[model samples]
Target: MNARKTWTRTLGTATAAGALAWAVVAAGQPSAAPTSEPVAETGPGYAIEDYNYPGADRILAEQGIVLKRGDGHIVLADCLSEENLLRFLARGRADVCFKVTADEGFLTLEIPSVHGVRTDDSVNTHLAMTAEDDRVEYDIPAKTWEGVGESVDGREHVLVEIRVTK
Candidate 1:
């Protein structure tokens, strides 16, 4: 063959081989496009929030108590964790106490069959309890023990919520 024709054929073959190699590499790789349509939430308008307390569900299921929500200010206390913690007395269950972390605190919980709550003078506190027919709120005097639930009305009451302020 002529030198110019031979050079031209060689260059064309190299170009064709390069294109074939590139197509093989591209076909083997995964596509970058999204696979499915975006999901639309259907049920409740409110987005489900993960307001889960770390161990609260297990505690509730095992102990038959519901400690649902808190603002990180008031938390369940180990009665022996600190001195002067607020204490609660229940009719059938052992006493439970709460430790106040901030100057003001709030916690929503359900402890059934509660009878009394004792507070420390450090923070002013309030309690809300519910009976079969009615809900009662109490302004607990600071540093004093207060009667609630069956102690006050002779009816079984469930302590529902608590709030405290310095």
Candidate 2:
């Protein structure tokens, strides 16, 4: 079971975007809300969906990707897996980081933790990007990031898909 869990999380940062397109898998979850909001900006883009946090809190926490600034610490999971992450991006300015482990002994795979760039508007109602360049500042709205994964029991699976809008 350890191998399975490892591979699952591994697909997170790597293939964070590309692989998600080709496969249909159920992701884990995220972390809980801050009970409030962070009061500083560091990375570039970030915010907090306070009201909705409790609903999807488990998903983010399980993902385990946290960032901090001063007396404030915000998890990237706190922003992702939502309809509107722009608020968090604008406020948190989080530098996205992700990690997903896999059972290396079972499968051999090549997934990018930082998949190039693509126009992903499949999730109707969410125009993640109006264009493909400088996602922050809402200029080009090009999103970029990466993921990590591994092979296990002869099957390739996903761990996480870390995406940053910048």
Best by lDDT: 1
Task: Provide the lDDT at 55 for model 2.
Answer: 24
The prediction achieving the highest TM-score against the true structure is 1
Evaluate model 2: give its lDDT.
0.28
Lowest summed-lDDT stretch of 10 residues in model 1?
37-46
Candidate 1 lDDT over 43-130, as tens digits, reads 4566565544557988788777788887777777788887788899998888888888888877889998899888966898889899
lDDT of each: 0.85, 0.28
Against the true structure, candidate 2 reaches a TM-score of: 0.17
lDDT for model 1 comes to: 0.85
Q: Give RMSD to native, each candidate.
A: 6.0, 35.2
